[model samples]
Target chain A: MEKILPIGEYIEKGINSLEQNLSFLWSAIDDGISWLVENMNDLFLAIPFVIILALIAFIAYYVKAGNKMFTLSGLKKAYGLTIFVILGLLLIYAMGYWEEAIQTTTLVIVSTIIALILGIPFGIWSAKSNTADTVIRPILDFMQTMPAFVYLIPAIFFFSVGNTPGVIATVIFSLPPSVRLTNLGIRNVPGDVIEAGRAFGANENQILYKIQLPLAMPTILAGINQVILLALSMVVIASMVGAKGLGSIVYQGIQQNDIAKGFESGLGIVVLAMILDRITQSIGSKK
Target chain B: MADDNNIRIKVEDLTLIFGKRKKEALELLNQGYSKTDILKKTKCTVGVNKASFEIKKGEIFVIMGLSGSGKSTLIRCLNRLNDPTDGRVYFKEHDITRDSNKQLLDTRRTEMSMVFQKFGLLPHRTILENAAFGLEIRGEPKEQRDEKGMKALKTVGLEGYEDQYPAELSGGMQQRVGLARALANDTDVLLMDEAFSALDPLIKSDMQDELLQIQNKLHKTIVFITHDLDEAMKVGDRIAIMKDGVVEQIGTAEEILTDPATEYVEAFVEKVDRKTIITAETLMFDNPIIVRFKKDGPKAAIRKMREAGVNVLPVEDNDEKFLGYVWLEDMLKLEKEKAKTVESALNTEVPSVYKHYTVEEMLPLITGHHHPLAVVDDEGKLEGIITQTSLIIESTRFDDKEMDKLIGEANEL
Candidate 1:
């Protein structure tokens, strides 16, 4: 205890340094938040691309179906999914906040992409080797069990602030489920299937791609669904780090003590969550 | 087809140990060390031990034992699925143990295909896809793969089930799909590890018949593994009876049934019904009384019987073929009835069977009929006699307890 530096001097030094950099950090955060708010129009513009991509996929599938039953089933599914998406849009419109909802959707899509890119390889690597599985498992457990707020703090520290920081926070919060589920899916494929692949003269890579991954697709898709839900939940918490979206509106409503505003924003989130959840679940169940 | 006499797989002193420090531990354990001591010294299990045998080309060579007899492990070792911890496995002229992984894979894909006990169909794939899986992996064109797959499926009597998923098929159908998968590859060697054991007994017998039919057409070298002795006898050209990872005896089915080399083999064979395995050919004498038929006269038949010094003579029609039998009593009766009809003295109660009838079929005829039945050829001519006494004698060939004790002692040595 005597050899350690005095607690008062340490506290004083920390305060002096914090004071010196506090203005810089605050201004950087402000600039990031302003950049996100200014580009809200661009985020809204991306919604048309999603609609176009969906329509193109639907048309491609529709033209390829030769059988009446298949074609009818495809039309039914397409109409059902379209109705779900329209209902979701109506819920957002009902809140009278189209720009904020679009921003939130953009952030979710980007963060989910990032999570998938990082999580899938980790899952594959874990499936390849027991050592990698053992090491990554505990880390995945930690990431999943650690509170969402904890991810936001570190994300804010690293990326400073803004939608990028918010995306980072959401990625960190949602990534674990995808990795864990992918590993589970690959590992749970029946032993006889793997043996059959081997007996068919498949190399390790061939077996992994042809047998393991395809068999694991449903479970992996379920995991992706979980990641989407987790990312949606993080959007509001990310507002505390100066990120804009529906989360910002919710936060503002909270500050001003406006109950209707908070409820509307929250309801919009719920609608978005339900739509994503249903789509992913339908895909998984079909498999 | 390969040369029938050439040895396709020669397993020499093969051993498989499952765990760490396997070789040294297995040696110590084999040297009579206690299990606890062996465990403390080196943690391993002896899955197979010094098993040696040769499977000839185009033969249905069965490896039979109870569960845990290492028969499955031994079959896998031939293809190097469960690599042996020691000794060599030669696939034709090539040493499989020394072959590179690529060579082994190539051999497995092209030279041999294994049908697992559980069928091992890719559950996600339909029957056609499952059957075509091997060809697809080998990079065959989709059209050719489907063509060969369909042909193979048709060969296994599964032609119309191409679109059905594995889950939609019954167990026997799934196993047929597995067979089709193996056949689709057109490999020379087929390894069946209890391939039909999971099916019900009735289905199993049907599958066995199907396998035999396929074997007749393909003449592929097959190494079958099973615990059921009857199944082995029904299908195996030769059999290896294994016990506790050691080969108890390896011989032709007839040789092993008639003369088991060890106590273990004898004990294993004892429970098997002997009559089912032995045939009339095994018990028949080469020479018997031959009688040609011309004129039907009781005095002539009596004179021929006296000259031949036999009590009975087979009577044939004008073409010198089997008509039936005429015994001395029948001849005397006929002599007494010489003034009467010739048909009145014919002894028509002679029981007979085909020369190919197995001992099992012949047993009841001999015991129930109270007479040595004549083994007739395909044309009903007398081939030989298969008596109950001959069958009993054949069965008691391994009855000497001294021989069993000697074998047990030899095993310890």
Candidate 2:
């Protein structure tokens, strides 16, 4: 092969120079994300097992939109999703992967929150202005379609191999759905309703806050559900960068060639993912 | 024409062009090009062309035309929902066309509110919240706004529907909520852009009646828009008739019907179902000649009928209350029977309609009955008699030229 394209070496040389000069920027981000992930894991560990179980059950009730789970009739009305969450949490405990599962849950939650905080406003900006939409659309396409492993390389280079890099990689992998859906939802609002808001003398901000946001909420929540699922899938890849979670258990089992260890941990991850997915999906379907 | 001070809103040469490049559209309009021609040339629609008219305070001033006549666009311009391309609108001489955004918002919020054709209630909000939307935007406290909303709901007869969403209601009920939303602002003027056109006929008629009843008490200045000519004739105090974005005439319903200013207006009014516009009040002869039942014997009854050059005389009691009617032949029969008073011949079974009833309604009542229809007041006091002769004269009153030639032929005969 002719060495006509030395694009890889050029990119490597450029990244090396950026790493040296932007050392301060990378460290600041590393410190912030590491601190966020650390305290969140510690908080989850400190809570007693039964209390956490009860709390998850309570949230299940709330998101199921006031299903009275205490009574027998209410239990039927509480739906299969809530029952699955309760059983899934117990199964993870029985498998003795409670701590690992919680670590994974913390990782997914933090990445999703950060992704949404950035994504929703960008989405709103995209919906409101043609220039912003034109500029942001291809950037979102790049983030979404690039391989997940490719993100870990840059994330590890910046944050230097920890759960912080994992969080960053997961955030990068999961962000596009949140942004795309929020934009779609807002754009899909009927024009007459928006005109009604304007015709009633509602200022631009009032129309956004009172009419558009409330109407778009269900679709935004659906975006959140997708973000959580994408973050979970990316966390397993993020384990390659020394991130602690159930992903490490599966990685260790694979490296050591232990089928029993791999199957148990993989089953634990499935249960945890199912519980989180159903609850988030249920909340979006409320009303 | 209202007094200067009594005019709630006045538009002066106001024009609205739908597409961009309004200068070209106005130029084309100035050249006397038709609206379609301007649209084809400039890809811009002339929605309203130099529309100048006044809405009297507390009057239901209707702007009416067929679909695509720009009646809806014209009404929207009053509230600046669609800004005009040229000229000015004055809401009490404030020149709203020159208002800043903040000034326009204040004008919309406090002075003039609107009702839309689609019943533009926010789907996410409860009916109460939607009704209180204008008040909420004005920064009123929630409790105060809810109180006003409740009162407005009561005015629209939607009192118990406060907690429901708009989608839960029927279209007519939804439009009433829209009306309540506008009324909750307590504005001096209401801009109704074909507010009842989305509804079916029965509900639309009910809504129109309810609006009139509400106006009877509130007396708010209402600028109504409708494609239906019958609705305009029913509700309008005075009407402005539009065609191809130009207001062809502005006059009372009678003026528009009898003396249309333009040939376009004449053709427009010519299609209107005249029975709906011509009420019994117009057809009735007030204080119609009568024979007193208490005083007139058969002989006197016959004498009164002979003097009046009529075969029938409506008999009234001493209290001026209508008793019945007597025919000259019936009195002659009474004389044959040697009856002294015409009471034996007085027949009280004739159908009587209230004064404002339309001829459309009277047609069914007139069927299978040989006698005249009595026009009465609320007190059953005889206002007039709408005999078959008067009905025939009134029905032919629309085309004066044709009517005059027919009368000329009859006189020649």
Best by lDDT: 2
DockQ of every candidate: 0.52, 0.51
Clashes of 1: 2
lDDT of 1: 0.80
* Candidate 1 displacement at residue A196 in angstroms: 1.2
Tens-digit lDDT string for candidate 2 (B16-106): 9988778998998988999889989999999899999888899999999988888988888888889999989999979999999999889
List the candidate 2 regions with Cα displacement exceeding 4 Å. Answer: A1-21, A65-73, B262-264, B280-387, B393-413
Clashes of 2: 0
Compose the digit string of candidate 1's lDDT tens values, residues A98-134: 6777778777877798799999989988987899999
For the predicted complex of model 2, DockQ is 0.51
Instruction: State the lDDT of candidate 1 residue by residue for B122-228, as single tens digits.
Output: 87788999999999888899999999999999999998999989999999999999999999999989999999999999999999999999999999999999999
Weakest lDDT window of 10 consecutive positions for candidate 1 chain A: A60-69
DockQ-based class of model 1: medium
| Tens digits of lDDT, candidate 2, A74-104 | 6666657667778888988988999999889
RMSD per candidate (Å) reads 8.1, 5.7
